[model samples]
Target: MMALFRNLFAAALFVGILAAFEPLNYKDCKSTFKINSVKADGCPQENGKCVFKQSTFKINSVRADGCPQENGKCVFKRGTNPTIKISFIPDRDLPKLKASVRSKISGGSTFTTFSLNNDNACEHGIECPLKAGQTYEYTQSVEIVNTYPVVDDVQVNWVLSDEDDSNKKEICIVFLAKITE
Candidate 1:
């Protein structure tokens, strides 16, 4: 009975810290392939074959396009000024990248992935501690200054996960996506 009570107490404390959103952080996904929104014209349907979504929703600082199962990247034309912003980032960090990575876009299982490469401050690490039933957020913006005419579509996807078990209590993925064109 005493041990049971002790476990309950610990669980409560963890819940409290997570509720506070303590272990919070973000990763700015950069691609060798840059994006240029103005030149790219519009996010393609059938890969630039469709009209841009026209809604009055709030636009996020980062603009992201959907990732296709077949395409390895979200493409953009070389001269089209790259827009390398992370349109949607989860409130929590997912598992660390493995050379033999296994990932599914938006819970779907057509595993299409790539190696995560980056710089300091946005290095390989974990961020967590966002309460269940609560929402936390992070945003990143990058201008795709480099554009190649050869490129066609620009695809992106976001995943919130708790791959780091060391900090069991601190785990989250704040979802942030582009709301405007």
Candidate 2:
């Protein structure tokens, strides 16, 4: 009997240790953004100006490190991998998602664009057939593939829509970003 109790205790301790190292749930996490090894508040700005934006979805937490945030926004570099994390609630079923990004130089006429489609939310690691009124954190990595002489601003947009009707967007999120180099 004593050996049985000891074995159970060991197993319980092992489980506890594993759970302690698990990544925090989206709601409970309070992570910060890092740019070039520096902590940032949001995306970067240009000429002391940053056009910050968000969406109707409830964002519990956000972090965009590769794209450092400054002056209440974030900044990205050309030919770099910029990552973004957002925890939000759809508030309705969303079978698919449409995401697009475009950038216009701060003082130039150059532009850069990238578009993606998530036919099945789960295929992209997002819960598909998303339950209405449930919150989920989405982390996406965007590669800046433009070689424009200048990339001043970026507009990140996402549309959550039903599978049957692409024209009907249940939710929309548009965020602006500043770029350098």
What are the per-residue Cα lDDT tens digits for candidate 2 across 40-97? 2233333333222334444454444465544433566777766554555665666655
- Candidate 2, residue 101: CA error in Å? 2.8
RMSD of each: 17.9, 10.0
Q: Identify the runs in model 1 with alpha carbons over 4 angstroms from their true place.
A: 1-127, 142-149, 165-181
After TM-score superposition, the amount by which residue 152's alpha carbon in candidate 2 deviates from its true location, in angstroms, is 3.0
**Model 2, runs deviating above 4 Å:** 1-56, 104-112, 117-121
Per-prediction TM-score to the true structure, in the order listed = 0.26, 0.56
Clashes of each: 38, 11
Candidate 1 lDDT over residue span 1-181, tens digit each:
9999999999999786333221112222332111112111123223222112211111122232231112223343322322222222233334332111122334344744423333211232213332222222322222333321222333333222233432321211122122112
RMSD of model 2 against the true structure: 10.0
